[model samples]
Target: MQHIVTLLIAIVIFGMIIGIHEFGHFIVAKLHKIQVNQFAIGMGPRILHFQKGETEYSLRLFPIGGFCSMEGEDESSDNPNAFEKKAIWRRMTVVLAGAIMNIILGFLLIAVLLCTSQKVPSTVIAQFAQTTDATTGETITAAESERSGLQVGDKIIAIDGSHIFSTTDLIYKLQTTDAKSFSVTVKRDGEKITIDPVTFHNDNTEGLLDFAVQGKSKNPVTVLSYAAKDTVATAKLIWMSLIELVSGKYSLQDLSGPVGTVSVIEQAASTGENVLERVQSVLNLTIFITVNVGVFNLLPIPGLDGSRFVFLLIEAVRRKPIPKEREAMVHFIGMAALFLLMILVTVQDVSRFFQ
Candidate 1:
């Protein structure tokens, strides 16, 4: 029963994300007077569909993907209202709408999560971990961070030159970096201070974080401020991960497909000791996933909206359009390659289940 509930929740959340993304394109196209052929919530064969005023709305079988299919999106057409006939600026707006919607969805979700929390976490160091010395049985400050110059009440501003907006940024910087030490920057005594080569370690734990941060009482302003910062932090994390993947710091095994994502959602749903905690856990994951989707879709990969926008930019510069057939062929090839990669990743995800 729990498994079933988790699955249902995952499906609903995924549907909402995909729906909003497609709706962005659909609404923008409509506003620009472009003809939309279909607005779909999923891919593959249609499970349910209806037509209204020249547009077909569909719920398809595969929840892994969705589309807002504009008329003449992939081919030339004589219709004045076709997507290809749109002004370059209008077309670019339509192309970017999906990613913008995904990002907005992420920000909204983050706000929702913050509203239910007791306090907002800040990047200021509150206290360092303490442990008893074995020989003397006396309490001693054990946090390597503290001994390395991080102090209580100091607000972390950056690590290794990357600005820290929230605790999320602090954690990402600490966990993802391979360096044994870091140049930490903090705001203390109304001035900025840089601590060079600060090393964080623990005797008993393998984790690097050795200090706790203070939390601020939540107010409307703080909630909004923190939510926006966290959203940007999540998006930056996604972008950094993608760059690392391209640089060969990560491999195919590190990538997650729809199945793996659902599995992760299930785990998040089952986390925490209470219902509220579980919901917060799931919401946090959803925020990251939505932001990640937004950032990934904006990458200039063929068959994606970003690539289409690039082509539009070229058309604007040249004062002419690329041949429709050639563009369509390029997208087709890119789509095929993407599908193959998805299949491989899905297989890996399924194999993990058995293992």
Candidate 2:
């Protein structure tokens, strides 16, 4: 029963995200006087559909993804309002709208979470923990912070010159960094101070940092500021993760598809100390996934919005668009490659469950 409920929830959430994405393109195309032949909420055979004048709205059988099919999107047309006949800038806007909407929705959701939740961590140091050595099991006494020139009430401004707006920013950089020593900048006595050569005793432990961060209060200014910072932090984390993947720091096995994402959502929604905690966990997951989706769509890979923009740039530079047939063929091949990749990742995700 729980599994069924989780699946239902996943479908609803995924449907909404994908529907909003398609709506962005559909609405933008309409604004530009382009003909949208169909606006679909999912892929595969249509379960339900209705034609309202020029556009057909559909609810398809699969919950995987959706699309907005514009007239002359992939071919030449004589109609003035056809996508290919429109101004190049207008077409670019229509193509770019989907990812922009996803990013907007992600930030809006994060704002909601910030206003309602009290779990956000701040940059001010609250206390320090006495960490134990992983190998020796020896408890290190307090004063690591004191000895390292860190003090309570100090506001962490940056780590290794990267601005630290919140604890989320701090943790993301720390976890991904391979440096042995780093510099810390803090605000103390209304003056900026730098502590260099700060070394973390990373004796094969889960966490290297020895300090506990203060939690922010649910105030208007605090919520708004932290919300913006958190959103940027999440986006940066997504960008860094992609870079790491391309650099061979991560493998295909580390990648997750829709199945893996759904499983994560299920786990997050199901595991919490209380009702509010569970809701907050789900909200956090939503923020992460939505932001991730938005950023991924902006990558300059064939069959993506960024790739379309790249072609437009080429058109601008060459004073002529690529041949429609050739462009369509490239996108078709890209789509096939993406389809195969998704299948492989989904299979890996399912196998993890059995293991």
Candidate 3:
């Protein structure tokens, strides 16, 4: 039951994201008075379809993805209203709009998340293990255990004298270091307080104590500042990830398509403690995918939007439009190659998902 609901959520989210993409082209094409044949959701045979005026809108059999089939989109059309018949500038706008929309959507979503306070963990010692008090024969705050000796509202600046970024980073240091006693630096209520490690784990995981970061919301500026920082950080992550992939530091297994994305949704649903956590995880994945979609589409590949811009630039340079047949042939070749590549990549995506 929950699985079905998750699937619906996945569809709605994908539709919103991809629909915005297609709408970019659709609206621009309409403004340019180009003839649009179909604005369909998905590929293959239509499962549900309708036509109003000249355009046929269809929901296709495969619910994986969608497109807007514009007249002369890839070739010159006889109709004066056809895409190829449109001016070079119009074509450029049509080609670039989808990617622009994706980027815009990413920013908007991030902003909304910030406005709603759907943020990373910022509270100190939000969760802790309960332990018994040996001296008083009563269960207290467990001041001597792994979560002990740490008071709330203490600002943490460093772990073992190393500056940390996120809560995850702080935990990583504790889980990675083997130091028994180290100086912890913090500012509690506007005073710098350095405390030696006192809490110790039973299993000696990293041979460390569990002193948490003390977070305070004394000022509203902190929230805005954190939100702005993370939004930019999220955007930068996308840029860096792509560079990493091209540099061969990232592997193909790291790539995910619809299959892999769905698997991730299911995994997060089970693994996350709350709906917000699951949503954040899914949105994080979506942001990466969205940025990749924008980035990949902007690449100068034959079938990509970037490649269309390239062809247009070439025509502009020569001061005459490229031959219709020549351009058509190139698009034909490009699309065929792209389709084959999609099949290959889809197979790889599914194989890795199962594995």
Candidate 2 RMSD to the correct structure? 3.6
lDDT, model 1: 0.89
Clashing pairs in 1: none
Clashing pairs in 3: none
* Segments in model 2 whose C-alpha atoms lie over 4 Å from true places: 130-143, 200-206
Model 1, runs deviating above 4 Å: 133-139, 203-206
Whole-model Cα lDDT of every candidate shown, in order: 0.89, 0.84, 0.68
- Of candidates 3 and 2, the better by lDDT: 2
Query: Which pairs of residues collide in model 2?
Result: none
Question: So what's the TM-score on candidate 1?
Answer: 0.95
Highest lDDT scorer: 1
The prediction achieving the highest TM-score against the true structure is 1
Q: Model 1: per-residue lDDT, tens digit, 110-188? A: 8889889888888888988889999999988888888888899999999999999888898999898889999999999
For each predicted model, how many residue pairs clash, with residues at least 3 apart or on different chains?
Answer: 0, 0, 0
Flag regions of model 3 displaced more than 4 Å: 118-235, 352-355
Could you estimate the TM-score for every candidate? Answer: 0.95, 0.90, 0.66
